[model samples]
Target chain A: MQALFGQLLVGLINGSFYALLSLGLAIIFGLLNVVNFAHGAQYMMGAFAAWMAATYLGVGYFWALLLVPAAMGLVGVAVERLLLRRLYGLDNLYGLLLTFGLTLIAEGLFHQAYGNSGSTYPVPAALRGGVNLGFMYLPLYRAWVVVVSVVVCAASWFVIERTKLGAYLRAGTENPRLLQAFGVNVPLMFTLTYGFGVALAAFAGVMAAPVYQVTPLMGSSVIMVVFAVVVIGGMGSIAGSIFTGIGIGLVEGLTRYLYPEASSVVVFVVMALVLLVRPAGLFGRQR
Target chain B: MSRIPRVACCLAALLAAPTLAADKVSDGVVKIGVLTDMTGYYSDLAGPGSVLAARMAIEDFGGKVLGKPVQLVSADHQLKADVASNTARKWFDQEQVDVIADLVSSSTAGAVMPVAAEKKRITLLSGPGTTAFTGEKCTAYNVHWTYNNWALANGTGREVVRQGGDTWYFVTADYIFGRSLEEDTTKVVKAAGGKVLGFARHPSPGTTDFSSYLLQAQSSGAKIVGLANAGADTVNCIKQANEFGVTPKQSLAGLLVFITDVHSLGLDTAKGMYLTTAFYWDMNDETRKWSERFFAKHKKMPTMVQAGVYSSVMHYLKAVQAAGTDDADAVMAKMKATPVNDFFAKNARIGPDGLLRHDMYLARVKAPGASKKPWDYYEIVKTIPAAEAFPTVEQQACPLAKSASPAVMKK
Candidate 1:
């Protein structure tokens, strides 16, 4: 039972990253209708930005948490306006290919600058140690990740569902022609939405800095797993993505306790099972 | 008029004579290509450092061979076998590269071997993936200059089990490296009267969570969890193992660990873990001095792979000078006969299967607070001799080993 609880904690931590990255991916897909292949690279950039700010500039984690996401969002805006905007009217496959090329270029540049060896990012002073939970020792930084990710996911959902700007954005996504007819600058909305989604990815990257090293290819490693989560959750619903991310994380954790060999492959197996059960996904509407 | 024409002819002959003499003295420059994974998994081991090591060796040898300047060029194979093979072909055909060094990744090296054979170029393989390249597919041109799975497992697993940590469970990365490492280590464990309770093979490259693997190991009741993986996979497995609280109960033995991995993991998580390697930066005064020099230039400690690159290149240059030709077979014969002396090793030699016979060490990670400085993580426990650390020639299943008369080879 103690081992089981420990696995759950591990699951939650992984789930937090899943929720953050998948939510961002879903948002970009919803607004821009382009699967941003460079999403992982942007996430890696965020971690690198945080590490550089801290190591080179002596900035703390708190400042990096705010600044890294903003910097990445700015980069996203530049990419959307300068590069992605050109492919807007073309086939969506073009966007995917273009973004993949961008991913390669971005990853290559980072590799040129940093090489392949990863740099360490220490956990913050306040959250450096673990707390004894009787059943298992829980690292404070991991708990913090879960709390922050949940809060961020909820806030994003609230803004998208409740706010007037979010309503306009959703309207723009559904019927850009009609939204533009109603004098809502749909193109600008699409650009901002893409920027916001990238920023969310960056935010997760910053959160992940202390847990993992800041590497040139760090994003690519985890991005596929996040994509798997996105697929299992269904690309259609935001809330579904959040729930599925956490749920899968827990299931993965439980498998670690009960069946360790399956832990690494369990998620993909679940993805395949989900596809068989509901091809569109658990939360996706049938096209 | 005849006397004036004779003087003009004499002057033209004098100019042509000097040009012909100069051409005889210097036959252009010798170009060597350093091909390896530049941006993928093995990049830390064989990327920029491998190229830099080769260049440094060339520079140390005065940057000239056969009275001509030497040039070093490199290409990123990106860990793809086909790409590596194709790159080697281009380097040989288009660039006229005489030798190719540091082919990292076993599959990539396997792919590049035939290219080197066909081209008849001297291939000093310091970082090629597996021992099998030298053992089974022993090419006359290819010189396996460093350690392999059998050596690594022999040094770590056999020694560890013999020292009393007997029962084993493997958390293996599901790939060539992991599979080979586990297979080698398991043989050592069983030979030492230890039993493998069970093993779990995790997917390579993309695995982020390792809780399940750790849990299974924990449940198996094995005394040691042998991690037969490298790079981010190894680091992640160890990190998640700590999270799952499996380490204190079951000992974790890393089949392969490098300085870079230690730096990323930090002393806190990695403390008390035992691992084996051919090189450690703080192993000795000589090693420390050499590593300090390298760190000053690259801002990173030299891994065994990087050091292997330096040693292999230096030895290859010497062989080329000795043989008086750049032919693969000639250079390889000279390399085998010659002794390798470097910062990380002394008196190393190429074995029958092309393995570099050198000492391996068992080291334990120190606590973060125990470290006197940053990068001070390991404490050496044992120095494994070259003969014991590597498989015997008889045990080497290479066709070359089988065909060769062991009587004359015994030194």
Candidate 2:
């Protein structure tokens, strides 16, 4: 029973990352209508930025935690204004292709500069140990990641659902022409929305730096899993994405405990099952 | 009449001299093709370092064999099997490359094998890929040098388990390398009276979060969490494990950890961890000298793959010198017969299965406080003999083994 509960906790933690990445993807897609293929690369850049700030620049986790996301967010804003903005007037497929190319370029440049070997980033001193939870020993950092990710996801949900700026952003997304007539700068909102989404991804990367090595190709592999999460959650619903991400993570963790061999394939299998049963998704609206 | 005859002879000699010069140039040049990962995951292992190592070996060998000067031409396999095979075909057909070296990926090596066999050119592997290239897929033209998953797992897992770190949990990368290493190491662990408590398979390359997996390991009650992964994955596991404090109480064993990983992790996070490897920069005096020279030129210590390239190329040249022909079968025969002597080994041999038998070592990570120099990471705790490091002849599953006599098999 303790084992089962332990696996469930594991699943939830994984779900947190899935939720965060998928949420970021959904937010970007909802506003920009551009599937950012470079999201993973940008995510990697965020982690590396954090690692570099800490290692080379002598910045602590506190500063890196704040500045890394902002830096990547600025890069995202620049990318959108300089490059992605031009593709907006064209077919959405062009935007997707552009982002894909950007991902390739980003990954290629990093690989060329750093090689394929990984660079390390240590956890902060405060979160460098585990707490005995009676049922199972919980790593303090892991618990912190879960707590932080949940809080961030909830905060994002609240801001998007409850705030005036979020209402304006949503309005701009739904009817940019009308929003423009209402004396609102819809283009700037779109750019900022994309930047915010990228910032979220970068935020996840910073959170992940101490957990995973900062590698050039780190973003490419996880992006596929995030895409699968997006597909399962239905790109239209943010709440649905959050729930599905965490749900899948728990399922994956349980699978690891019960049948280790099938843990990896379990997510895809669930995805297929979801596709077969609902066609759209659990919370996704029908086309 | 004499002047006319002399002028006609001079013109004839000048025209013939052009053909003679062409013949001499062709005879003196020996082309070697380096097919490796130039732009993918394993590029660091075999890209620039491999090319440099091969060049150094050629220069050290006096750059000539059979009175012919050596020339190297490299191609980016791009970590793709089809691309690697295509490159090998091009090298053999168009350039007439006498040898091909540094095939990085297992699938890439597998693709190049048939082409090497057909072309009758020597192919030397210095990177981790297919053990089958030496085992079931053994070809007369191929030599599986340096380390493989089996050697790595057996050396590390067996030693750790025997030393009472028995209960095992694995945080494996979800890929071929991870799966194979975990599967191979599990056998060693079980054989040593250890149980694999559980395993967590994470996505390859870009998986940044191991919190969930480490939590599972922490809960497993396993004494050791074996990382049957390499490169970015291993480093990430180590970093996260430190954050989670998975080490010290529950030991961490890296099935394949390179010196580069140690440098990245620093001795603080990596301390007290055990790992197995085929080569270390500070293993011996000769190795130190070679490493010093390599580091001076490249600004980084040479990886096992880089060392493997040097060994493979040096041995291949020796085999070619002995065989007197670049024919795959002839060269392979000479290679198997002649003992390999290089920085990595005293006298290695190409076994019947085409696997190069050599010593493997088990080392423990030194604490950050214990380090006396930069890049000094591991302290050698055990040296697995060449015969014990690898699977024996009887355990070998090669087709060639079936034909060998029972007496030969016993030896």
The candidate maximizing DockQ is 2
What are the chain A TM-scores of the candidates, in order?
Answer: 0.97, 0.95
Per-candidate RMSD, Å: 6.6, 5.8
Clashes of each: 3, 2
What is candidate 1's lDDT per residue for B1-411, written digit by digit as tens? 899889999998997985554332123667788888778867876788888888888998999877777899999987788998899999888877888888877777888888888888867777744657666677767777767888778777877897788999998887776788888888889988999998888876666556656766877779899998887778877776665567777788988887778877778878887777778888889888877877888878888888888888888888778866555666677787777887767888876667778888888889887899867878888898888877676676677756757652552
lDDT (C-alpha, whole model) for all candidates: 0.81, 0.81
Residue B168 in candidate 1 has what lDDT?
A: 94
Worst 10 residues of 1 chain A by lDDT: A128-137
DockQ of each: 0.35, 0.49
How far off is residue B286 in model 1, in Å? Answer: 4.7
What TM-score results for chain B when candidate 1 is compared with the true chain B?
0.89
User: What lDDT is reached at residue B134 by model 2?
Assistant: 65
- Model 2 chain A worst lDDT run, 10 consecutive residues: A256-265
Deviation from native of the Cα of residue B74 in model 1, angstroms: 1.6
